[model samples]
Target: MTHSSVPAPSPDQESLFAAAAADYARYRPGVPEAAVRLLADVLRGRPDPVLLDLGTGTGQVPLALRHAVPGLAHIEAVDVSRQMLDRARDALAPVLGRCTLTLVHAAADEYRPPAPQPGEVVRQPDLITCCRSYHWMPGPAVLAMADRVAAPGAAVAIMGDGSLWSHDSEWTRALRELIQAYLGSERRAGTHATYTEPRRSYQEDLATSAFTDVSEYRYPVARTWTPAAVVGYLRSTSFAHPDLFQERHEAFEAEARQLLDTYTRDALQEEAVFTVLLARRPGTAS
Candidate 1:
């Protein structure tokens, strides 16, 4: 696999994700049921196949896909967080014995294809998936790696940036204010309250891998939560300011609670809807 030209997230940012792992699993919503259905369509008719899930945070994508593809024989779920891996292991225990569920603890960029021994040809995976975690790696690196790790006709799916919500939503406005106040100028430039733009080249970048018949899908789904749930969800984000300052953390929590109550009519509700991009490698035996 060719190394990605895109740089990984900063060590401090990565640490934030690691610290937020538990909260993320507790409050972070799973993949949408509709997106899972789309993945089922992408993997339909494939024989007992092997799958590699890049950036398999807490194994949500694998869990969702396994539900759709019950006949899958093997799945390798990789992530960088030990805490996240532990949660994934616990969540996937029921199917662990049935299917080969290998939980690899490593950053996606650093992961390498298994070395072949004498007289042994490594088995390339039939399907490769990058769920919400693709943004962490450089796009060029991922495409190059996919070319090397996936079989000739393998299917690769990149699903993320599907978050589409009302920019005018009160919660959105409050969160923006809170981010600006708490993060100051350090907040990512051009970042909006909603997931609007594509973070990377979707079709063109993946096409560089020489995959044929590329396609994309967008699915919309929503989840509602109360004020407390909103707080929990906010704590799950990598940009969460809670851990940075103890006193300020308490103050932020109080402010968030009040803002949520005011905006959500004392209920504090928000929803997230996203699109899933589904693509395939050329020469797939149909």
Candidate 2:
């Protein structure tokens, strides 16, 4: 990553993540280790691969990959929220001595790693990951940027899964309705922004970008959530962020707890399916 040129995100977009950083760092589930292995395969020939993780909220990608991928020599993690970066720094502290870590407090679009210093040798990143945070980025523009900063065989992975509010299970359906009763039917995100579904999928976006070899993988996961855990998870998300409830925050939590308890008494856990979308330069060994 180079520091010379990068685009900035709108203030509204930047502030949307302001309040939830702590919750996000505390409660957002990690990317599965299996996913890290796939990422490692994409960078097979690079002896000391560099990683550039965009929208790297709480540094989850590196934290998950550090132990799984042995040759990762450096990681440049970027995020919009300073608070999120703060938490990420704390989480990454133990690994600092082993890996060259750079934490950038800028929106995904506006971040660029500094040029290598004198006596330093730097290569374009072998893997660029934007997990669960690609939706916040400027789609094709970010891909174009990746094409510039990535190595010839490097891969760019854009990943996420539908959240609790979007799950279709009976209990989840009821949970959605409960959330809507308080926050209305439209999905809200980051402060005042409402989610507007992208017109194209990440596959389509990558197909048209410079990194044209696109592939996707899905992982089915089962999660057991205590009522307290569920509440904490909701606080981490943009749609059900705590501030949305305003004066009704406590009431909403109480009702949400009761609703989850009633559902769990019959079925002990919730299950979800997660997907990972990987795009690479043509001819890369995947």
Query: Each model's C-alpha lDDT?
Result: 0.67, 0.80
Could you give candidate 2's per-residue lDDT for residues 118-237 as a string of tens digits?
Answer: 988865788999998888788998898888888878888998877887777887788888888998899887557788988888888888998888788998878777778888989988
- 10 residues in a row with least lDDT, candidate 2: 1-10
Cα lDDT tens digits, model 1, 126-183, are 8888887776666667767777787667877887742212234567667767866875
Alpha-carbon lDDT of model 1:
0.67
Quote the positional error of residue 98 for candidate 2 in Å.
Answer: 2.6
| Per-candidate total of colliding backbone pairs | 3, 0
Candidates in order, TM-scores: namely 0.83, 0.93
